[model samples]
Target: MTGKLYGVSVGPGDPELITLKGLKAIQSADVVAFPAGKNGKPGMAESIAQTYLQPHQEKLPLELPYVQDPDALTTAWAVATDQLYEHLSRDRRVVFISEGDVSFYSTFTYLMLTLRARDTAIEIQTIPGVCSPLAAAAELGLPLTIWAEKLAVLPLLHNLAELETALDWAETVVLMKVNRYYPQVWQILRSRQLLQNSSVVVRATSNQQKIYADLTNLADLSLSYFSVLIVRRSQQWFNSS
Candidate 1:
């Protein structure tokens, strides 16, 4: 009997944000695995779940590099899948913890896909947790969307035209992983006079979390990889607060 694989979302940053079911899965698992951090530091998922993990549980760090190279990604996923299969073949329950929701831009999705492709008999389950957009909204004390408000969540901006299109249609726009394209984004928002209605939240819910409610003078602000930018077409809600 092959052991089951649990892809648990540990929330954005705060350990307490983890759901009861997710916490239970982590504590009961025979092995706990998370993405390896950069420069030998603990990854965001590991940092959030560390306090709840048991000493007896084997910790595994799977290397899932941040890159756009298809071949490099495929190789890394294959190696990580094999590593998990080794323990799963012996019937050891393995829990792979992700920083945010396992379904939303998560590495766990790739890992799960690779595992299923490798072995059709593998059992897998995913537990949902807080994603960055929701966490950022909470930190900003604003509603992500109101009734009938159209919302668009975009990844890194590869083209400014896409941003223009989103702003034209969506009442609310969320830009994830906006660190690199922040200067460009700032310029666009500035041109459209949306700076006052825009906000930036970095490392939401973490100890080092930073919040910029008014983007009026943040054109040159440098942000980290975990930054999120929220642009609202209406400043009514923001101005009232």
Candidate 2:
């Protein structure tokens, strides 16, 4: 009998943010799998869920490298699929923990798809948690959306034109993976006179979290890979508070 696989989102960085169901899955699973951390350190997902892990549970760190090359990603996912299948085929309940919501730009999606491609009979379940944008909004004491406002969430802006397009139609815009594009993003917001209406949250909801509620003077700021930039088109959102 093959065991079932569970994909659990550990939340945006805070251990306390993990859902009860996600925590239970972590503690009760026979094996816990997470993306292997770089530089010999625990990954974000592992760190957040470590508090609930059992001593007897097997730990599997699958190396899911952060790269854009399709071939490289495919190879890594295939290897991870094999590693997960090894325990599942042996009737060991395996739980793969992911940082933030498992369905929202999380690496677990790729792993799950690869695993499914390997065996269609595999049983899988996913649990959602607080994504970064919502966590960032909470930290900023602002709402992500209100009334009928249109929201746009984008990942890694390949061109500044995309930002222009989002600002054109969306009432609220969230830019993920904003580490390298901070300067350009700042200029765009500044040009549109929306600097004061924008904010940046780094490592949201974590102990090391940093919030920049105003982007007026952050053009040269350096941010981590986990940073997120939120822009509200209506200045009333900022002025009201």
TM-score against native, each model: 0.97, 0.97
Query: Model 2, residue 171: what's the lDDT?
Result: 95
Stretches of model 1 off by over 4 angstroms after superposition:
237-241
Q: What tens-digit string does per-residue lDDT give for candidate 2 at 1-241?
A: 5788999999999899999999888888999999999999999999888888889999999999999999999999999999999999999999999999999999888888888888899999999999999999999988899879999998989988999999999999999999989998999999999999999999999999999999998889999999999998886665666
Alpha carbon deviation, residue 53, candidate 2 (Å) = 1.2
User: Per-residue lDDT tens digits of candidate 1, residues 1-241?
Assistant: 5699999999989999999999999999999999999998999999989899998999999999999999999999999999999999999999999998999999999999999998889999999999999999999988999868999989878888999999999999999989989989998999999999999999999999999999998788999999999998885665575
Evaluated at residue 232, the lDDT of candidate 2 is: 84
